[model samples]
Target: MSNLLPEEAEEKLVTVCRTAVGDSLRSLTYFNRFDYVQVYLREDLEQEADLNSFIGNEWHDFKMTQDAYRGSELGDYEYTIRVFENGYLVRITVEDFGVFVTTDGISMQDFEALAAATTEILDEWAIEE
Candidate 1:
């Protein structure tokens, strides 16, 4: 529902992610400060329909991530990857728009590709805005 992130870009992000991780993808959420889109979710996880609710709680936190390591010894914050027992969580924030993707076990290389593509897409849109 964000003017900065139309349905086409939302679908593009989902498509890029699926192409990167294929069937390992669990779900994807595209969000801005205003609202979020449940871009993709595998059928097996349909019963666990609380993902949006969970994401709602983290909007502020996700926004905070943008300034989190600003001007540190390391370069700017690109993305975040959290490993869990069963899968992984990837968060990429850009200006006011961002995406959070959940995926099953995937290689580090694939994760990097996904993050890079996701960041590039969001960054490009942010520039246009």
Candidate 2:
């Protein structure tokens, strides 16, 4: 139940991401087929703690989706958040919000931070039209 339409929400999300991850952001891709937003980071960046936080949000959503007993609060939400030595991969779907962020040189802590930041940004975005 977001106040904004799907397209508006998507645009706001892209703006928020760009504002929050300015210099480190390498590219932004929006997949119309799946309504996915992809944010790629620079290869030389280092923000493991931030990135880890971001992944944690995805994990939370994943767990919610896996819980059969829980009501459909997430609504067709599904995701994959993977981290490795060189980079990390994230694919998420929550209602009309689907985002994928792939980055290089991420650590456990960084991933979590990134997830956390994204969650915060989305929360703020959700409040607006």
Candidate 3:
């Protein structure tokens, strides 16, 4: 698949995610130099689900982790999903940017479906370029 520059990817992610899960999607944050992204979804989930929340301010810690290991591929380019009582979060490194996700009250199944749809859009965007 063709790749996208971090800023380009971040823009696409915002559009894709908004279309995919606008209702449950709380916010989208991307850090290009740090290669970080976050997607926040509404949360109301059960334990042992395929996805889990990061408990407490782990999302903040996550940002710190990205800040700490900014330029290294091994340190920064990993995907993390955290499900908390209020919501869920998805963090990933793409190119030189990072993606973060947060949910306010969405179920696990719905969140996954929305995320899949968002990813599809990103893939398609890459191919188009």
Q: Quick one: ranking by lDDT, best first?
A: 1, 3, 2
Can you write out model 3's per-residue Cα lDDT over 13-113, one digit (the tens) per residue?
Answer: 66677666676677665444423334333354332322223322344555577677789767633556677886776654433334566666766666666
Cα lDDT of model 1 by residue, 1-129, tens digit: 456456787689888999889999998988777777778888888646576675665566765665676777888877888888989989888777788899999999999999988888888888988
Model 1, runs deviating above 4 Å: 1-5, 47-49
Q: Cα deviation in Å at residue 106, candidate 1?
A: 0.6
Question: Best candidate per lDDT, number?
Answer: 1
**What ranges in model 3 sit over 4 Å off?**
1-11, 33-79, 121-129
Model 2 residue runs over 4 Å out of place are 1-34, 37-80, 83-86
TM-score of each: 0.84, 0.44, 0.45
Worst 10 residues of 2 by lDDT: 29-38
Between prediction 2 and prediction 3, which has the larger TM-score?
3
Model with the higher lDDT, candidate 2 or 3: 3
lDDT of 2: 0.50
TM-score for predicted model 3 compared with the true structure: 0.45
